[model samples]
Target: MLSLFLFQISLNRMIKTLSATNYSIEIGPLTESSFQDLLTNKYAHSRKVIMVDENTHDNCLEFLLTAFDDLTDAEVILLPAGEENKVMEVCFQVWNALSDYGIGRNDLVINLGGGVVTDMGGFIAAVFKRGVDFVNIPTSLLGMVDASIGGKTGIDLGAFKNQLGVFKDPVAIFIDPSFLHSLPENEVWNGFAEILKHSLIADSSLWAKIKNYRNIDDLYTADLIEAGISIKLKTLLNDPFEKGERKLLNFGHTIGHAIEGCMLETDSPVSHGHAVAIGLLLESQLSNNRGILSNEEFKEIEETIKALYSPIELDEEQIAIVLELMKNDKKNSEGKIKGILIHSIGHCTFDEVFEEEEIRKIL
Candidate 1:
């Protein structure tokens, strides 16, 4: 059904289930029975709705339909693809569709696409009629490792990333790595950016191993996927919400989101992963200048990231725009711009207010 096997590890060897406070994530080597049986048993009586974007509609929706007959009657909602589509207008339209379908709180929504689908669909289910149970069937590498795993569901407000949203977990998340084949190379790198961030913030050994890879191919193994998932899970254990330790996950995201907004204004828009890759390097440098990260470590971080990703060249105007947006980032308090920084690889510090001048020094 899905090439049977996509990686070196066989079905059984790859790690299986992981749980957070209320939900569980079922990683690769999934079977029709593993997915279908649960749906038939648990959701037989619930109205089914499967939401996806244009790409997932063409690439992934059929695979899911063929695998699970339980979804035969599921209402399919197809959203327009791309970051720009992740807006309140789209959400409002989806809401109207839900109303048209007669969907209610007792129903179930299967978010069957990449990050955008899971993020926006979860938001739709959460706020619709006070809340509807939803599940994530992440079909992108980024979706599998980061977006779908966390309870953060949101849409962009203009160009700002995740500007409007909620922190509501899906009932379950089904991550089948077979879907990796459906992605273009750029899409794969987008997810790798988040996974790379994970290694830096909490897993030094993982980051060390990651740097040794000469080809991006080496990064796409089930072993690494499971390991990355575990690192993100570790944070959820102590801080399910972004109340404390979970903020570490937002390290590269602050500047990354701002960079993302800047590119959307240009001719060639940047993908989330591309923007985050750039943000990681800049923030790592910011950490160094702020005296939190060591000089040698910053060089290593810069070298490793630059080798894999082309650095973004922001013009003077764009730099000012990015700095202004950083001041208004969600992580900031009152008026100070704050973000996570690694004092050492695999370790980080937060609640550090970065002065505008300090940020300008790095930019």
Candidate 2:
């Protein structure tokens, strides 16, 4: 009886290993010993390439080099930093660089920066030579919990957000919290918005934990990252293609993305998290106006985000442009704008359409 039971347990473990190949998210420091084995055994024959922005190259590249001795021969491709550079032109440069270097189907691309690097690098690898293997080493807090977990990869189309892209999962994702040490304080705050979004949409317990935190600095830890990542991974497992449950993840992105697009057009641009913080407030107000979210909950959500992020005041003209951009969002259908609104904390409804006039009133 004991032998039979052990056999069943082993069989289940093998089944799980076989089934989990499509997606993975690993959180830990990248040390020389573990990484060397990964390179020697798993990626032995594959050519290696590491993609980074100027910022990451300056701040984070040495850590990777020290971790993997084999990377001495890996080609390094550096793109410009900032959301403004997350465009087709930059992608074109990366693609050209790959072609010039003769990168093949078996070669691996390592995305080693924040959201922009991961998003663009994943998109590049997804299409390069008809999809090559890639891994994400997320350097920013936003990247660690949010961008690196989701298979969504794309470059912005003009002033719009993620207008061109594909769903391509990396073979593995390595999240090293040490990367956050090099980021500025505002960048850390930028990531907290997504964490708050995760909490708002799925975990009320996480929301309670985050709301009490005095500052972004206090929120940086493996447990916090795991909380946000668990929400995202669980959501994606249910709706990998964003056909239903995954849409809930866009809680603040509707207006947030529109605002981001508008800001990208101006000389002064807000970070993705900054724009999302604003979206959280506006959308929460929309939820309140629609009689879904309670008055007290709305106030709490508004004040929490406001305390973390300074207000971004937009003129009427900018509001109009943002509203127009919403029409082009991938979530919309049949000429109606779709939004995800919370009925209460930790619960949300998606595919909720609102009229242009209704949205205008809120702005």
Steric clash pairs (candidate 2)? none
What count of clashes does model 1 give?
0
Looking at candidate 1, the ten consecutive residues that score lowest on lDDT are 1-10
Residue 355, model 2: lDDT of: 81
Model 1 whole-model lDDT (C-alpha atoms): 0.83
- Please tell me which predicted candidate would have the highest lDDT against the true structure: 2
Q: What's model 1's lDDT at 357?
A: 88
Per-residue alpha-carbon lDDT of model 2 for 1-363, expressed as tens digits?
A: 000101111232211111134644555656622345667778888889999999999999998887677898999999899999989998888899899999999888999999999999999999998998888889999998899766889999898899899988887777778789989889998998999999999999899888867666686787788778778776776577899998999999999999999999797899999999889889999999999999999999988987889988789999999999999989999899998999999999999997899888887
- The count of backbone overlaps in candidate 2 is 0
Residue runs of model 2 more than 4 Å from their true location after superposition: 1-20, 32-34
- What would the TM-score be for candidate 2 when compared with the true structure? 0.93
